[model samples]
Target: MAGSAHGDIPLTTISFSQRPNGTVATVTVSNPRKLNSLNTTVLDAFLSCVPPLAQRSDLRCVIVTGGLCSVGQQAFIGGADISEMKDFSNAEAGRTFINKLHLACKALRNLPVPVIARVNGHALGGGLVVMASADLRIATSDARFGMPEVQRGVPSTIEAAMLPAQIGAARARRLLLLGDTISAQEAESWGLVDKVVQADQLDEAVEEWVDRLLKNGPRALRIQKKLFAMWEQVPLREAIEAGVWEFGTPFEAEGFEAEGRRMMNEFQMQNRQRKSRL
Candidate 1:
């Protein structure tokens, strides 16, 4: 695990760690005592981690996992800290918090590599948003997923917006409006989580998925990620134009041209050898 400390942030609510897995990096969130609630400190620490990650050519995938320290063998994160809500009496304070939250989510979404959520336990409220923002989500059978914000007297702002896009609008409302928690299995059924594994098998499941991702050509994955980010904003032709330039421009650049060509040649050679044997 690797990270530079961010001691300047006043809130001690978030901790960061970087664990290298071949070409993939795993950034863990360990604030179990606080149910992994995100405050200003946590957001700052996360923001500090993003830029360096984006610049790494070796990175192919990323996984974000939550810490579990609460009662029962359940949940990755219970929810955000309601106590922190006491300070937001006016619109300005609420707007500031929301903006920070939006930027942090955007940073995760904009990551050059695919980001997976390894949901070890319960993920609720803002924790759920983090999971949703990830490109893929894998949860343990015992894990519970939900947005209990309504129960705490607040609307599910960011999550409400993304959840509908992930699952259908109806299923998203069923969970958000009712504030009901669902098992990992049910979440997977509704497309909230991509997969659910036995508790003991969670780590292995995550590794297998990462292995599959790394097997693909890196440039292909990066191009796919760029297109995905643009799909919602631009028309088909414009999005294609944007993605082609976003992806192709880098290839013509000095270092990328050589490395990418070499990798493609190697991949073709491997395919040819395998086909010959077959």
Candidate 2:
């Protein structure tokens, strides 16, 4: 909303609301006073709350968003709180800040189900990385996305490292080096986000994705999510082999074996139905 993240309105916090029988969760980070900027309070809340969703058997999808402002702009998350960071006196304080921010995003990345970033407004600096951590991103047409940490005299670190993969290295460099914000359309075209819709259509677009994801087998989604994260850190050949190895687990590992069998039976039934008239 402004050039600096120093304003204050409501208390910084993160809240999770489960919708429609607990299968979908919407985690909203509210710091409207600062345009939903990330600070210790909200980031700590995120780190504490998000990782536990991985254990939710009833949870099918998570929509991470910073709710829209009064004027209906997506104030999704405005980045780190400059006032807090400006007061940090030493390297240790900075490292501590980075660690918390990194862990919060790591929690998002490690989620068992798909994470959809419901980008409503300003996702800049740390906010951009938080959006990048999601499996999919649905942004409002007026959403603003970028990395402006350089302009603030700080290097974008931690999850910012994922930007080159999210958007290209050159594009990520453009934002980081120039401290510029890109429009939602540009972000989608550059691969920084997945979908862009008008503000009025944001929730509908997100729900469409959520519904599609909910149709998949839960065990398959969880296994696939774990594998996707692994693929990012391993060699290409190794990643492929790991997928093969991972599928074998469903044949006899832990609690997934039974669910895998059930899915197989369903698949067989569907195949048979396809051979006949519905």
Candidate whose TM-score is highest: 2
Scanning candidate 1 in windows of ten residues, the lowest lDDT window is 7-16
In angstroms, what RMSD does candidate 2 have relative to the true structure?
4.5
The residue-level lDDT of candidate 2 at 31 comes to 78
Clashes of each: 5, 2
Please state the error at residue 144 of candidate 2 in Å: 1.1
Task: Write the residue-wise lDDT of candidate 1 on 83-112 in tens digits.
Answer: 676689998887788677777677778888
List candidate 2 segments past 4 Å from native. Answer: 1-22, 70-73, 253-257, 271-275
- Per-residue lDDT value at 93 in model 2: 100
Residue pairs in steric clash, candidate 1?
Answer: 75-121, 75-122, 76-121, 76-122, 77-122
| Global CA lDDT computed for model 1 | 0.75
Single out the weakest 10-residue window by summed lDDT for candidate 2.
1-10
TM-scores of all models?
0.82, 0.87
